[model samples]
Each structure stands twice: as C-alpha cells, then as structure tokens.
Target: DLSEILSLHDFEAVARHTMNRRGWNYYSSGADDEITMRENNTAYQRIWFRPRILRDVTKVDFSTEILGHKSSMPVYITATALGKLGHPEGEVVLTRAAHEHGIIQMIPTLASCGFDEMVDAAAPGQVQFLQLYVNADKSRTKKIIEHAGKRGVKALFITVDAPQLGRREKDMRTKFEGNASSHQTKGGDKVQRDAGAARAISSFIDPSLSWKDIPFLKECAGDMKIILKGVQSWEDAVLAAERGCDGVVLSNHGGRQLDTAPAGITILPEVVAALNQRGLLVPPGKPRFEIMVDGGVRRATDVLKAVALGATAVGVGRPFLYSMSTYGFEGVCHMLQILKDEFEMNMRLIGAPTLTDVVPSMVDISALKVPTVGNTMFGVNYETMYPAGV
Candidate 1:
C-alpha cells in the first residue's frame, strides 16, 4: 500500500500532513528566522553545474572510502537524535536501511534507543560512526566512548556547533520542543523523567575543548578514527589536523547554528586550499585526512560538486529524516539508491572515471563571484547575501 505513496518530494508533503503540527514544526523548523537554513539550499542553486559529455557512460562507479571505511557511495547519513518519533524501530530502521545501501550511518549519542542495540542491529562491518554531543557529565561521555569502542563503531564525530540548541522560532512559536531528558523507549536511564516540558537543553559540550582536548579524545577513542564536525574556517581545519583529528565535517549544523555563518560549501574550498598547502590532506602512506561536508545537499549534482571541491565525502541531514517521516525504512533506502544512481550519472556526465577525477577544473568557479562595497573588497557571506570581512 505504501509503495505507491513513494517519491522524495512526497515524503516531506506526507510527513507534514501525517505528523502533528507541533512535531512537524520541531523537525522542520530551523534556528532564528531560519535565514541560514534558507540560504543553505539557495546557495546550491546559485552554483550551476557544467556537465561534460562524450565519455563511456555505460559503466560508472560510486563506491568510495572515508577514513579507511568503504561505502557504496560517498554519502553518509548525518546523525540526528530521536528517530523513534518517526517510527517504532527508530535508529534500527535507519541503520538497517543504511546498511542495505552500504553507506555510513552516523548514530547520535542522544539517540532514543541504547547504543548497544543500534550497533547490534547493524549488519556486521556496515560502517557506523558514533556522534557525541559532549554531555556535561565527562564520566558519562567517557562511558559512551568506551561503549562505542566495544561496539566496533568505526569513527567518532564530535559535533561542536550545538553547545546549546539553536533558537528555532517556529518550534518556539508552536511550543513544540525536543527534550533531552525524555525517553521514547522503556527501561533506559538515558531518558529524562518528564517529556512535556519546554526549555533549552545543553549538550554538555566542553567550551574548554581546545587543541588541548584532541589528545585526550584520541586516548578515549582507542584507535577509532575521530572527526570534528561543525568546522567552518581554514584556521579550524588546519588546527584540527594539528590536534590529530582524522577529518573535519565542514558544516554549520545545517545552518541551525550560527544563523550568519557562511554556507558549508562556501568555506569548503578554503579548507581544501589550506589542506593542500600543508600536505595535511594525506597521511603518512594513506590518503589525506578527509574533508567532508554537509548542508543543503538535495541533489546528486550537489554531491558531485562537494567531491569536486575536495570533500572526500558528504553528509545528508534533514532530507533523509524527511524521507523517513514519509515512508519509513523503505523510503530511506530508496532515497539512498536514487542518490547513488544520480551521483554515478553525474560522475559520468562530468567525465570523472573515479571520485579523484572530480577536480576543481570539473567545477566552473567563474560562475562564482565576490561582492564589493564601493572601493572596498569583501568576502561574500552567502548566508546574508551580502559582503562581510573586507
């Protein structure tokens, strides 16, 4: 019955209609006026694709590796908390679908179900990265890292953007909020006793996280690759390397954090340029530390664009959840399949035999321009659609 209801766009429409307005608002709404959220997609539109032809398009490969883990495609399922809100299986459904597609699924630390259950549900060696929110309880954070290590999670993504949740006006107006202290399933100490309250919840992110914490994180992670998510500047990218991070997920938390920050794509080139300058991109005998990006990625062309700009891979957020809301596990699986197909088509049309062939030359940056104020030059802040930092 549900197969007939399938379509990527329909997922959003159906989800909006099926879920309570409050729940929908909580999931769909972004921070502040959602200016950055709007810009995340708009900036992608501004960059037009110049597809190349005249290649043998019959065969195309979408498989790639990120930090030593292989994936059928370069897309990773960006972590989001509380999947049970959409379905009973929650992360199990999402991870199972991701495993079926052979892509990475980053499981959130604040996930509704126990981490062990999620790891157990995943197909063995099906690449799952554990995402942590840096809880106020350092001991709890340590226990989480240890738990993940035992689960054979491939990597740890420390999300830094949400020291505290963003100001989602729509959710605020609707009085719909996501509570950290609430439990979706029975018998977990992770859930808060009260789920009905509305208030700001902190991720216990260590504001003290400096270059100093990197070594400690390495110690805690054992040998699991560590990536610092939410990096948006060249300095931070380079520092991440110095601090021994395996990668940097260039993002602004889908523009949910820092409403005025530049789009992740806008700063990606800068990060790549820095990596190339220092030779930090590749490790001793392996590929360089990965530079992955996420935000406003809705199409395969966008995935191609990120790869061309030096992202080893890209992460997809809200849209996957939207698909989940619309059609559950099958919807998410189909979404990935469609993206993989599109990515391969894009690679062939753009004359890329492999992911490495997706070079800067493949992208027409001439279409990219900077803005000015009279005689003063300034960097274009894509979020504000204006000039900043002259």
Candidate 2:
C-alpha cells in the first residue's frame, strides 16, 4: 500500500490516522499560534522559477556534499527529538533509512536509543552528524562531543535556537488532557507540572549558552566540523563564521522554538549576501563555509529552490517522521525514493542538469520584494484543525 503513496503529504495523512493521538499532536503541532510554521512552507510560493530552456538535460545528478560528505541529493535528515513516540523502533529507523538512501542523518542529542546504539547501527563509512543540545554540565557535554568524534561523527551541529522549549499548545493540551491522578488534590501544593513532552524531556538544556562557549565546544569537538544550527539572522551567521565555526544553519528551530520567526529560506539570500560582504563566505583554500537552511521544506522543488539560493543543502524532518511512523523502514525508504524521482524529473524540467546549473538566476525573487509579513501570513483563509466536539 505504501508503494501507492506518491507524496510526503500522503505519508502524513496516513500518520495522522494511524499514529496515537498524543504522537500525532506532538509531531504535527507548532509553537504558539503556528503562524511561523505555516509561513515556513507558504513563503516558498512567493519565489517563482525562471527555468531556462535548451540545456543538455539527459542525465540529472542531484548528488552533492554536505560539509564535504557526499549525499545523494542536497538534502539531509534534520534532527527531530523523541522518535519512539511515533515509531516503536525510534530514531534507529531513520538511521537505517538514511543508509539505504545514501543521505546524511543528523543524530539528535536526545534520542530514545542510546548514542552508541545509533552510531553502531550505521553501515561502515556512513557519515553521521551530531545535533547537540549543550547540557548544563560542561563535562557531560564535552564527553559527548569527544565520544562522537571517536565514533566518526563528521560534524557537530550545535543547536543554538531553543534555549527553552516553546509553547506547543496542541501538544500540551493533549499531553495534559485527562488521566490526572486525584492524589495531587490532597497534596499541599507539591504537584509537578506537565508542560508537554517537549519540556519534560529537555529540562537540562543550558540557557546560558553564549558566544563565549564556542571555543570550548571547538576544543571538545576535536576534528568534527562545528556548525551552529538555528541561526536566524545574517548577524549570527556572520558571527559564527568569524568565530571559527565551519558553517551555520539559518533556521528558527522549524518554527517550534520561536513563533513568527521568518522562514529559513526567505532569509538565505540575505545570509549569503552578508557572509560574502564580510569576505567570510569561504576563506582561501579552506573548505567552503557551508550555509544550510531548514524549515517548511515539503517538496523536492522546495529543496531545489533552497539549492538555487546558496544553501549547500536543506534539512527535512517531519515528512520522514510521518513516513517512518506510518510504515516503518519501507515507508521511509519509499518516501526518499519519491524525493529521488522528483529531484531528477524537476531538475530536467527546470533545465538544470546538475546542481551547478541551479544558480541564483533560476529563481525569480521579485515577489520577495514585499515585506516579509506579506510573504508570510498564509492568511485567515488558512485552515486549522480542531478537536472533535470543539
């Protein structure tokens, strides 16, 4: 039946019906009113393609390197927490799927499976990256970084956006709905609060993580390319490069950390422009200071749009989760195959035989001339889901 699933949304539709209510809400809900979440995808609509004609498009190669690691396409599996919530096998399902597809996977700091377990699951020479949530305890964080280096984690994508978990009310409401033990009513105000799985699982994150800690992290990370993920503005992107970070991911934590944050794709041009302005886009004879983006990427066309704008690659998270949750390994593999098919077909239609041909001119950003508010706000016409009997 999964073979009949044509798009990522099909997988999502299946996930909504089959996964538990808690898992479904947790996986799909965004922070606050979810404006930024919707904006993340819709913003892509503003940029139309200026596809060129008459190019030798016989063979299309979407393969590219991320921080020098070869990937089948300019796409990598971005880290998402609590995989077991949706699938019985948890994050390892994604690990195996990435292997089958030959794409890179960023292992999350908080995975249901042990760190070594996922790393051990990898095929020989399969490159993995670590998405670290710096613990309050520096020694523990250092140990994780060092261990990852020894395990051959090629990069450290230190998440810088979520100092504290955001309010994903849909997840919280369902998380807190019912099943309350009445014993708490007898207590003299010693009851613990349930702020949903997001806060419960992420309590140890150090809010004091500042620019000063980069050098310490670099020292701990050893040879792993240190990339600061969740960079929102051009300023932070520039700072990361200047401070010796190998690259930066312009993200808003997939609109889960900060509501109303601009989609990463919309900001990619400015980030690239600023990085080039400061002469830090790529230093002489050094590995290119990779600028990646994630958030609101749904289609392979969205991936190409990001590629066209200066992103070395794009990170996709939810679609893979939906696939994995619905049908496990085969589901994830099939979803990836769909992307692979789209990449080749779209590449040809757009007259891009290779990623090099996916230059900036291929996209017409004139629609982006309006203010970001206009670009976002998918409008009151934007439909929203509600609980039954609401």
Candidate 3:
C-alpha cells in the first residue's frame, strides 16, 4: 500500500475513504463557507517558478535549521490537534517519524496523548516544539508552559487567531446526526455537551488573549523562545517583533478560523517587507526573529516558493496527518521520504544547490493577489460533499 502512494494528494484521497466520516470532516472542514480553505491551496497556482539551468548538479543539500534547531529540510511538521482521531498511536507516531527523518514536530496542546507521554516517545536528542493554546485559567496555562520548558521543548508557538473556534458545518452536521464524541476531563468526567471536536475541545482556551499577554507568556515560558502562530497581517507581524517574540507564523490557522482570511503565502511578501522595513529580519546565520508560513502546502515546490519569498521555513500540517491516518508510522515515514526526494530533484532543477540559493529571484509571484472571490482548485473540494440530502 505504501508503494502505491505517490503524491501528498494521494494520501488525502485514501484517508477520506478509510477514515470515519466524523474524523475526516474534523480534519478537512474549514470555517463558514470554506472559501479560505479552498483558496489556501489554489493561491499557489498564481505563483510560478523561474528556474535556472546550466548549473553544476553534481550534488545538492536540503538540510537547514529551524528556530535554532537543525533540520533535514526547509519544512517542519506543523501542529495539528487530536492525532488519536486519525491513528491509535496519536502524536507519538509523529514524534517517532520526525526523529527518524531528522526534522522537527510541533506538538499540539490538545494532542490526544499527554505532553509528557509524547516527549517520552521521542528518541533521545530529537528536537520538538510545543504549540500552546492558552487556558482561561492563567495559573493552569503558566504551569503548562513551565512544564513544556522543563520537558525540553525548543520553542512555544502561542496560537493567536482562535479566541474562539470557527463553525465547521460538516462537523456540526455530524454532531446533529448524534455521532460526535463528547469532550472529557482528565478524571473521565464529561466537561460539556458535544458540538463537534473543535468547539468542544477548545472551550477552555482564553478569549481575552492580547498583545499585553505576550510578556506574561514569555515570563511564564522562562528561557524558551516565544513565537506567535496565527498572525495574518503586516501590522501584527511588526508588533510581534516589537514585543520581542523570536518569530511569527503568518497563518490563518490553516484557513480554518476565518473564512475570508488571505492565504499565508500570499501575505508573506508584505509581512517580510514590513519586518525588513522595521529592521527586524534576522541577519544571515543568526538565531534571531524569523518569519514562517503555513496553510495549503502540499508539495516540495510549495516549500521552495515560500523560501523564495523570504520565509525562514514552511510548516506542513494536513498531508502528514493524512499519511498517518492511512498507513500509520510507515505512511508518515514514506511521506517524508517523498518530500525529501522532491526537494532534492526540485533543488537541482531550480539551480539552487543550497538553501541560501533559493532566494526571491527564483520565483515569479507577480500575479498573486488577495482573492476577492473563492477560487476552488486542487485538494479537498468541499462543493461535492453535500448533494441535496434533504
């Protein structure tokens, strides 16, 4: 079965058929009309590569560092919640696979497996980061952050977009069918009625999170690096740098939170320009503030395009989860291998032998504009899902 899979899209197609409808919808559905979700992937179509030829293609290296940690490529496994919904082993599968591949994994706060357990599953010296969903209870949030620091998490990615979870209609419909599972507390007590996974699980997240809270989170996190994960504008990116965050992920929470938000890649140029204008771009070979992007990255070329636009690196979420859902740890391993292969070939073709060679000049993004209307193309077409079922 692993041999049969070729592209990241293939994993998604197989996962759709193999996973339960509840789980698949939870992973795939975006907010409101799902326009932003579709745009996240299709936005890549507007950017084209300006590859070079006649370069020495004897060897190429894809290895790079992320947030002061070395990685085998210019991508990391971005945070995704409730991995147990996809596989029995949950986030541990990611921990193991990331270790094997020499990359980093951003462990989610709402992981099915507890934080310590997931850390325990990682191989010794394996680098990992923690994605924090700040709790309404400040003391509880502080304890969790301090715990992650003690547990050797390399960084803290505080999610800033989701003050509240978005309404994913598919998951809501699944709940209305009485098939959704209830959220439970650590003592096996039911916390609330099920309203699909996102809302039910995210009820504990603090709604009043703001810029003023950054210093408090930094203080709570001790010496670990602090980065905001859901920023969508140049203004916030500048403020994040001003607030002394180590990095900012220009994301719309995978287009799952706001339906009309710009794709992460589309806004990256402006964010980079703003940061540069403020003298915030990190000088080469320094471990300072970085800019990262995520959302609708399905290929090595997508990663390459982001790097060309001044992103330190790219974050990939859904494709790896789909791989895990389809074939467990082996599938994850295979998926990473596929990406590694693609990066090598693409790098050779693009005439960028090193990560530094993949610069702004390598891609043409002149046609990239903020979408005024939803344009549906490649990956997870939501239109075909409902067909007059009433």
Q: Which pairs clash inside model 1?
A: 181-192, 281-288, 282-288
- TM-score, candidate 2, is 0.91
Candidate order, TM-score descending: 3, 2, 1
User: TM-score for each prediction?
Assistant: 0.87, 0.91, 0.91
Question: In terms of TM-score, how similar is model 3 to the real structure?
Answer: 0.91
lDDT of 2 by residue, 257-309 (tens): 78988888878877777787678887888888999999888789999988888
Pick by lDDT: 2 or 3, better one: 2
RMSD vs true structure, all candidates: 5.0, 8.6, 8.0
Give candidate 3 misplaced runs (Cα > 4 Å).
Answer: 176-190, 283-286, 370-390
Give the clash count for each candidate. Answer: 3, 0, 0
What are the Cα lDDT values of the candidates? 0.73, 0.84, 0.83
